[model samples]
Target chain A: MSFEWPWQYNFPPFFTLQPNVDTRQKQLAAWCSLALSYCRHHKLYTLDVLEAQESPVFNNKKIERKLSMEAIQVVFEELRKKGNLEWLDKNKSRCLVMWRRPEEWGKLIYQWISKNGMVNSVFTLYELINGDDTEGEEFHGLEEWMLLRSLQALQTEGKAEVFSMDDGKGVKFF
Target chain B: MDRFSWSSGLLEINETLVIQQRGVRLYDGDDKAKLDVGAALLSTHRLIWRDVKNHECCLAMPLSQIIYFEEQAAGIGKSAKIIIYLHPTPANKEPGPYQHSKYSYIKLSFKEHGQIEFYRRLTEEMTQKRWESTPVSQPIPTGSATQTGKTRAVGIVGIERKIEERRKETDKNISEAFEDLSKLMVKAKEMVELSRSIANKIKDKQGDITEDETIRFKSYLLSMGIANPVTRETHGSGTHYHLQLAKQLGDMLQAPLEERGGMMALTEVYCLVNRARGMELLSPEDLLNACKMFESLKLPVRMRVFDSGVMVVQLQSHSEEEMIASALDSVTDKGSLTAEEFAKLLGLSVLLSKERLLLAEKMGHLCRDDSVEGLRFYPNLFE
Candidate 1:
């Protein structure tokens, strides 16, 4: 019989620390991982520690654990320390998630175009995604920011050209 | 010579006195001094004694010397008393009683005039623990010398027998206390009471105790050690060992942090350490000092301060691999693995693993995909 996993005992604050030094260190690491995982799973681009409820770290029920302001700061601090995340607002309510680093994204785009025999072909932004260009490929759901960064990188390397007209439309070519 | 005096209080030529509670000093034409008055020490007023170059010299007189001044018509600087004595010589060692056994220096005392309530209180405290004066030794009786020698020999034998008895008692007590300690945790109250009674015996017989005896007693009592060790109330030069006690308390909490992958909060550590110490609740200052001492030692673990001024203590070598391995092992039993699926896993919640995964992606250990669902990492296509 498939075991019923139950309601997944979602004590939210377990993801958060107890404002204690040692507990908080453990909590921060745990929360940062949870947050990263959540972001990666849902393809979330930005996270607001304030508004996010499904973020497991914000809920605490099993052992009545809770995250103090300091605990939240520590988790964010951990992310910032690793250079994988950034605060988006002055109040630090939101943070930009860098799922893959900018440089690696550049390298991926370079490799993808060369391998696909699209080096000498021109393609529209929509065609790159919804068109046949990236059908059945990993780049199908690539974020606009990642695509833009990859395109800019290719342009820098003289591997591609980007053109814009009076109507404010854009296209790319190898 | 009586250095300076205003009231009935006497001032010395080269001695420093803190106005525990003030009074006056009177000086005669022959450079004699006396004082009588009242001054409060808690006020903003401070009388710093100094040498000619204005260092910490004993020659500076107490502010009570101002008690010798007459009621002068208000002059600002002149109204205050500033008496300079000859530069005093430094002691062969730091000043303590019995430093100069031979020639006595001028001694100063204050006699209060008005509202000497504070002075009276001070005197009461000083006199509470009065010294018993024993007369200077006369001669030992010569007739009993031979008998006394025999008695002394017998007395030594008796003391040795007593010491043996005490040793067995201490050893038995220690072994019992530790017996309970070895068997998980027992009733803390019982342990404390056991220790307390033993401490009482140690205190009562301290006069007859030798160093070896005391050391043995302490070793046994270590099992029932201080329910409350040195506190701020009982801290002084003699209690540096209290730091070691506090450090041991910190050590007990190590297992809890270690279990959670070498990460813990500073405040939690403080609470756990203090709780383990039982009655030894350390002040915030003591806790901070302990943390700092640990930092200076450059232990394998470290204290961290976040951007939000939140402090935490974590391992310096905290490895993401350990966390990831634990997380992966917990989940690897299931066949399929996806980025979002892994993110939802508790094993992935550890900070080090998240960092490692990011690094692995950067170093070609993994690759990531940004889908409408979210961002996900998988085994690197590059690798």
Candidate 2:
């Protein structure tokens, strides 16, 4: 996308951390919005700090700009402070985006299965991902481990039941 | 020849001509006082013959003008005279009143009356440029590079090799000077680009910026202009002169200083001035001294030391009291102001935020609000 004022993108001060607290706060806010937009649009759940290829926030093509590690940390720290994200690993290299958290994802799955009347039906873990029953749900490309965990959470809440068949991987839902 | 004698000896110069202004002082050997010539039209000083003609033309006297010579029998003015000959001789040599031992005597004492007349004629020709009247600065039209019998300058036979050597030396010096200047110029251009891009970025994100932030941004912005200022290293023996050159650099910072309400820190000036000077940098002491000297002389600018002991160079025309009064009036009419809001009302500079508030408070122009959310500022408590 072309900026109306392309010179704004090329300005090197954009890369520097403003020492003034008020300006830095504003800068941080803008950065947060940019990061959220990227994560949501790309359907990305985790961001690798070391990987420059995947993170869209660092990619400023028109100006050939890239945010510093400190800037990236500041933005993520701000997001974490706001309870909108979490570091999946302690070193903070990998961050799990919680703008839409696992609990919310689980809730979405529950709603979809109930609407499709598949809450009482049986299916294998493989079939649930590859199954016709979940035809138009957010569950289609959902990670298998995440889907199991979410399903298990639903079971614990008494919203559904799971029964194992001869195959340990197979399960019947009720 | 008589004209030369009259101009060199009888031309009484005034006092103002000999006094050094803006550059190095080349003093007269005999006169501890200013060499008195005559009053000059350009200034109040004595007009030396050389200075009167803008230093391009000068009169020369023959050695016979020496009415009485001090014989160096044992050691009396002889050593000092010897120094004149040991040093680099003047390229266009002239015989002054005194004869020094080191310089070649040129067989003057042996050649009597007739030789003196010949010497006078030679001096007159060299001084008047009798041969230089020819306008042909181009190649001799001998049709080819290897052609012979081309007319050359007089007395330049064995001196031809010396002329070539001198030409090469001069050419080398000129090219080296230009090369250094060009390098500095290119560096200056790069610095400008760098600073521009930085300032542009800061400008783009101006919305969330606070007054203190704007102040800092301004400082950064000021420094951006001086990407390639001349420094001391670039002009080694001319640091003082270069310092003066840097003051001219401060002229460009005027608009930014004015916008920031008429004062900026020396640290800020230093960064900006050094950057602008390119490779020609003045030391911090030199910069300060230059500023102090400028102030002492009642230049348009002055150095303002705040109550906090922070030094800033600013235009004397800027009035802090007026700014505070105006800021007070605006804030009081509104009844109150947050520090952030107040900064917006007045263009806050890089001076300490607390100090600004403290000053306003002291002036009965502002009051503090330490509330649950955060510390803030409001209109003066008197209202």
Candidate 3:
């Protein structure tokens, strides 16, 4: 629940986006790294800009400096360009933080399924995400869209089958 | 006469000979008693009578004070005489009590038949119109004249002889030269020559003075006079005057620009050009226009306006690459470059230095660090 911020987070100019081109580029890069690291430490998959405005990650209370919404959007845009973030809506009020790429997540899921001997068994998306049997797993309580994308990646590799039932989406591995 | 020569040795600056008649025999009034035989030179400003036997005993009279000039017909026994009546300058107007009466008339007999008529017409032309409207005053006596009678006067006769002798020497020539108001054209040339000689003397004594003092003295001499001023009357049209003035300004800026490392702020250039110009000062707009004219003329100097709106005049040979290299060297040596520090390195004003630093930053030659200590520049390591 606690995240140790980089030393630059306390630097005042770090919160204020630099106006110079080169300085701004470096500042954006720093912001992107800080955002990703902070999100990963808290296991935060969704970042709401309005909510982040009040969070310690975006607002450095010791320095009395906070990134403007526009500055935050610019940093997020850079992250999105690097395939590290996905805008959830047209307004970009929220973004899906890809702490790990879907391909990497798909490989992790395959390892988990093989270790549990569930290679020939079927499981509901709900069980795979929030089931008691999958407790303490990295994919536990993962967002459905991200989980489905990871499963689709696995299906593309011919390692799993995805099906729909009245209960919800299901995945079968062979 | 046919053998007469109006030599430069006899004429002073601004003294143009309007008429010269040789074999002219001057007499005392109409008595036909010949006083002295001399060659007469009529100038726009004065009449010079150089004694045929002794040129040192030459006499000069201002044409403005000439009361009358007449050509008398030849009597059976005498040749025609050209009579000139002169009103001696008033005692108060005269600087001292020298020889020559307060008012006198002299008659000159010429051997040439039409010479008297020619002298009459030339005298009319010289005296009819005043060369200058200002009334002529007697020339001030120099130190030599005043020293002669004052320091050693045993008796009135001795004093009179000394004054006469001094009058025959330098004072007479100088006073005559000064008495003519139109002689300013000649005086200006003399003044330039005199200053040049003084400047040379100062240059000889340069070792005695400090470098700063020497520079100050040289600048004083340089700004003392403008020999050929560009005026509307001299150049004829406004455009020509501006063009000529621009050329003059360009030439004048060369030394100062070199001193300042091939660049100077426009305001500084404006001040320098105006100071050198003295009376004929150009407006800032005129200076800017003149600078703009430099571009088309392919002059060696140029005017540049920085992004921050500061303008400067820099030489065409000035290289931004060289400036950047120097700036980088300074930054490396000093670690960081403030406006003040960069100003010293570039020999420019702080404001201008800051502008230059910003320009370098824009050009990717340097980077800026804006912080609590104010803006400082470093070499663009990012590039």
**Candidate 2: which stretches are off by over 4 Å?**
A1-26, A53-56, A80-88, A152-174, B1-261, B264-383
Candidate No. with top lDDT: 3
lDDT of 1: 0.48
Per-residue lDDT of candidate 1, residues B219-314 (tens digit): 566534445665655655223644554455445545556665576667766676555454545676666666655555655556665444556666
Models 1 onward score TM values of 0.30, 0.32, 0.51
In terms of lDDT, the poorest run of 10 residues in model 3 chain A is: A11-20
lDDT of each: 0.48, 0.52, 0.71
TM-score of chain A of each: 0.66, 0.65, 0.86
Model 3 pairs whose backbones collide: B1-B22
A8 Cα displacement, candidate 2 (Å):
10
lDDT per residue, candidate 2, B41-149, as tens digits?
1112111233332343333332222222221121433211100001233222323323233332211111112323333343443344322343223322211223345
lDDT of 3 by residue, A4-55 (tens): 7777786555665565688667768878889989988888899998999889
Which segments of model 1 are wrong by more than 4 Å? A1-30, A60-66, A156-158, A165-174, B1-383
Which of 2 and 3 is the better model by lDDT? 3
On TM-score, the leading prediction is 3
lDDT of 1 by residue, A30-134 (tens): 666676666666677777876664344454445343455565667677888876678888888888876665556666766777887777776766566566767
lDDT of residue A153 for candidate 2: 66
